[model samples]
Target: MSLLIVGATGTLGRQIARRALDEGHQVRCLVRSSKRAAFLKEWGAQLVPGDLCDPASLPPALEGVTAIIDAATARPTDSLSIRQVDWQGKVALIQAAKAAGVERFIFLSILDAEKYPQVPLMEIKRCTELFLAESGLNYTILRPCGFMQGLIGQYAVPILDKQAVWVTQQSAPIAYMDTQDVAKFAVRALSVPETEKNSFPIVGTKAWTAEEIIRLCERLSGQEAKVTRLPMNLLRTARRVARFFQWGWNLADRLAFAEVLATDKPLNASMETVYPVFGLNPEETTTLEAYLQDYFSRILKKLKELDYQATKTKNQKKKTSLRF
Candidate 1:
């Protein structure tokens, strides 16, 4: 059966496409630009040029696809808000998919979306989940926690650069799963018949606090990392200031998320119940330590390259000065 992967150029979407292709499935990718998604073509994906924001662009993308895995996300710079993309765009896609006779629709949602309705992103995800459930189409909602790849860029890089990793007043532990693992589950959902009309909360085996993660980075990099704990009130104040200035992006949403992260709330539901349903072992997921070690090694290699370039430039300048 053929599968259409929305957001095929994104990190998680690419992983899903790769996994599906490896399993010998015919894969079609919905991308805004065929040129940006050219690499997907090399991976044997049929590229369909379309934008999620544009309802008119979706029917052609969904045509003749047996199933769909929607990993598309709204960017901060997009003309539409998260509500528009997650609700309106997704609804449009669902309507088109049903019209195209697509059987299965797998949606990638944020974990605890219902619990954190105050957060705009999660609120929109919850709304989309409801819409998908009532769409009269076969659907599977996979709510995955934050990705380790994102954490590496957000927390690990700052720690590696000898900069402080910031946290709110009450930092909570989060179950950050690898996107590849999430993709694996998504692909399995597409192939597995029993997963239809079900929702699964995907998470890693362990929950990691910001402090614990920072220390792990330090241990892996052999460098001491600093931590900065900001008061909740301060973050709220900063968010207000940003809103007053009409910042380019939504700082309020970001600050709201930061506050959510500060609480000791569980980011995801128990994986124990969902894993067996998917025929997965919780222990199979990547651990924080393993992810950090690999990430720190890459960071070290990059730092060495930068240092070499700087030294070479300095030596060249020294030689030129001596000649003068």
Candidate 2:
């Protein structure tokens, strides 16, 4: 089978490519850069140069492809709106795939896309999911829980800081998944008959709270880091301040953070279901101790460079103020 993976350079997309290749499928990556495609090339994937918003660039890649995994994310470089990428681009891809005689459409959706209306990201994903279901194409929807990578990617600030303090409402337990698991599951869904046109949820081994994640970091780092829950009013105020400083975070994202913190939406997916369907057994994930170790190890390396630069500046600041 020939599979075209959009967003092939991304974390999840890369993992999907690896798994697909291991399963003896010819994998073609749709990447925006030849440089980014190099790694995929090294991993034995053929690069199909393309972008989501540019339909003219995509048709060449879609030719002779059997399936498509629409993993394209909206980035700052995108001239199109989120609607254009998530909805309009998705619709276009479906039409192109149909024209190319593609068999399956694998969509990456979020949990409760409708319930989380405050965040435009979630809303966009939900909108795309709707388009896929109605497109008359065979589709498999994988609604993953929060990604563990988000800890490093989106929420890197708190994870890097000495004290991991987030302005969340309260520590709400969530079922997060490693991107590796998501990739494996994606491969299974693409190859296995049972998962076609089915909606499956992939999550962590166990549900963990934000506070627990902080504790895990502390344990991992072997450092005493506090998890302080900020007041909702203060969080809202801080978000406003953040926005004033040209931070592009939406108000809805802030509210969603609040909702997760305040409420207990114990997500309803189990490893039991995932193991049998995908032949995957959950691993003993890092508790607070292990996470902090890896987190701080990387953080300290960056901090050391900053400290060295600061010291160099101070050493050069010998001239005294001449004001009498």
lDDT of each residue in 1-324, candidate 2, tens digit only: 899998888768888888899889999998889896798999899998877777778789998999988667665444455666776777788888877888998988877677766666777788888778887888999887676776654244555555456536566677777677788788778777777777777777677777677666655545665455578777667656655533334442434446544656765476577567766555643332344356667877878899999988776674333332
Where model 1 places Cα greater than 4 Å from the true spot, the runs are: 241-251, 301-324
lDDT per model vs. reference: 0.84, 0.72
TM-score of every candidate relative to the true structure: 0.89, 0.78
How well is each residue in 224-251 modelled by candidate 1, as lDDT tens digits?
8777888988987877776664442354
Q: Report the Cα lDDT for candidate 2.
A: 0.72
What TM-score, to 2 decimals, does candidate 2 have? 0.78
In model 2, what is the error at residue 245, expressed in angstroms? 11
Which candidate gets the maximum TM-score versus the true structure? 1
Error of 1 at 302 (Å): 5.5
The alpha-carbon deviation from the true structure for residue 52 of candidate 1, after best TM-score superposition, in angstroms, is: 1.7
